[model samples]
Target: MPGLGEIIRESQIWKSIFRHPMPLDRRNRIVVMLTNFFLHLHPVSIKKQGIALSYTWCMGGVTFFLFLVETVTGVLLMFYYRPTVEWAYTDIQMLRDVHSLGILREIHRWGAHAMVITVWLHMYRVFLTGSYKPPREFNWVIGVFLLLLTLLLSFTGYLLPWDQLAVWAITVGSNMARATPILGHEGPGQQLLTLGGVDMITNASDARFALLGAREVGEETLNRFYILHCIAIPLAVALLLAIHFWRVRKDGGISGPL
Candidate 1:
């Protein structure tokens, strides 16, 4: 006779969802991993040494966990947020006061900074162990991109509060783009853009202008940054993160000694 576990596995709901029994055996284990969405990020087997707390420091896993925290808190914060300049600061204030959702914002903000630190530490550990070699080379490149995206996610988010500090900070940060070689008004080689007595790369069309959406920071800048922080950049980062996780699994799990 079938065991109780087998009988439960045969139930309609279990069969429809799991389509397999608990991973009690090697084949079932592999099948369960391959079929599940979350489990697929992990290999069916990993180097035992790689999982040691001292060796790996668990930095990568911690970074991913913090990302999950930020994503969830960010979504919750969005429910009370308005991207418009008129309502932007007011909304954050409301979160702090009326809705008492300030903790969510605090968690999201600090978690972002913490994510940056953990990602750096994770890369450092990988480097120390020479894990960037051979089959992991492409994955290292993906990590580099993910690091950049993490910084960008932080940068775009800095402007969302729409306060004087946020505005001025982003203004100064955006102004640095004006020195981007030919693309910026004050950048090197900009002298070459005197074609037909018209400066092809003037302040009107320079990087800073494009970033702020005007000559100075204002509603448009806030709106643009909000879209980028809340939607575009996060979506891009999530896609890159998925690719990073998949690449980790494909490269034979976490790297360790050969």
Candidate 2:
């Protein structure tokens, strides 16, 4: 009879899962990467210069890795989190004191900060290397959106703890939205906005109010930020990230001088 290894290799389940043989040769390696959804995001072949640490800096990969880490740890933290004003602070306190889940929160918090730093470094590296030129310009725009999403995610999560620190931080942050030019009521041209003789923009209806879901940051704000951080922003980031990867392949893979 054939060996167990051969039997397993030839099994229908294995074939279905892998769709190709082990990449024992260059051709098979390319075939394997092209056939797999995850690996397919990367090109079948990469130039030495494209991957060289001194050239690319690898900050993009690090930022993406930190994003994934934050997502996983954030989901785990959600199990013990409550977004209500009454329960939010207590829940965080319990996680810190009783449940020993402080480590997970620490990872999420520190990972968020790290993601921000890595993303900026990645953008700076791209700029320094002139990777933003030509076909890579769209990818650079996508990277900018991703950076904004990272910041939004961090901002939304900041209020979940519902502590005095969190409250004051978010209050100050949201207040900054009032100066967002046309979208904000307190911006320069608020007097120009009138609908049927009534002002369309007001403190209660402006950007800050929309962000907080009320005049002040409270239970409603917590709930809104929870939904945004846990669902909406993450979904948008995932979709954009997929496109970002596909575009990298479409743009002839990672850019390098040679």
Candidate 3:
């Protein structure tokens, strides 16, 4: 009689799901790698040095892990927090005091900070390892974009608290957009671009207005940042991350040596 393992492998349910037997042989291994969705994200084989903890530092993995943590905790926080001026600050307080869910906010906050640090370190390690050369150049560009998205995610989330620090910080930060060349009212090229001899860029219509959805940071800014932090930026980051990982696999797995 066949063994228990063999019996399970031959079952219809197993065959339907896995579509392959145990990867005991090279052909089976190849088939398994290609057929599995998660496995396909990685190479069939990676160099020993590429996976070494000392060399890789596992920063990429840590960063991705923290992103997952943030996603989970952020969703939990959203159930309690409101995006309006009246309830936003009170909701945060409720999470901390009333519901005792303060740990979730703390975890999400620290995870965001950790993710930023890990992404920078990951890029630094890639540069030091010469991983951005030749075939990996395009992926490096993707990484740079991902880094920007990470920062944007953090910035947008900063205003959700609806506190003095959050409001003023966003005010100072958004003011910088007013200095954006050509697009900003106070920017260098604003005077040159005129519609019927009238300056097009103004305080009412400039990059700052576009960012805040108003002349200043208030209700509109709070709602806009809430949507961006919880929806827009995260979706964009997810898309870029998918491309980044695919490129890593296409560029011959993790970079190892020269």
Candidate 4:
């Protein structure tokens, strides 16, 4: 005569998947937290002030939420986008003007912008609260790398639209790599790098060349950026983010008072 909820909880399928009973008691709650993947990221206990809205501003959580939104919307956008020069711009136009889910692109765009801002704000908050001190210092460094990755994600995504502004902005941005000291042909120490008395660094072999995969930004540039935006950079970010969160839990949860 057990209830439906109880019957379901007792089923073999449920137990196999969950591996633990309902967290109705303290022991069960701890066991659940230890066993579950997502729940394991959080500490068993957190300071009251650590979670207070006024203290943390919840920027970190918001940044992570926006990243999730970007992932979903970006995936949806990929369905309608073609990275080739011929179809790239046209595909973007169709998404913006012709497709039923055109708004998905807009959402992804704004979410990227928001994620950048929130990550900066989150870093600022951590600095202001002295959260970057001591045992949390390593995690702070991780956060700094995360901030760079966030900006890289934005930069890589900017070109997917294939608009004039996007192309020009990337052109200007990528040009900065030409001044990369020893690695760039136009950089400071290029003349010093010689192989058998021949200058090794040139327009054809430099940091910018590596980035664009050619001397100029064209089909290859678009393809490279598309891969970075859709795959390589996201994978790196995801791996770093996993470490960042795990370090947070290990560093004694969120930063409390000094």
Model 4, 125-169: lDDT tens per residue? 999989999999999998999999999999989988889989999
TM-score of each: 0.90, 0.91, 0.88, 0.91
> What would the per-residue lDDT of candidate 2 be over residues 132-198, giving only the tens digit for each residue?
8998999999999999998999889888889888899999998888876777888888778889989
lDDT of candidate model 4 versus the reference: 0.91
lDDT of 3 by residue, 53-147 (tens): 88988999899889889999999999998899999999988877888768899899889999999999999898998999988999999999989
Task: Please report how far candidate 3 places residue 131 from its true position, in Å.
Answer: 0.3
* TM-score of model 1 vs. true structure: 0.90
> Which lDDT values do the candidates have, in the order given?
0.87, 0.89, 0.91, 0.91
Best first by lDDT, ranked: 4, 3, 2, 1
Candidate 1, position 247, lDDT: 83
Candidate 1: which stretches are off by over 4 Å? 1-10, 23-31
Clashes of each: 0, 0, 0, 0
Q: Which structure is stronger by TM-score: 1 or 4?
A: 4
* Candidate 4 wrong stretches, greater than 4 Å: 1-10, 20-31
Off by over 4 Å in 3: 1-32
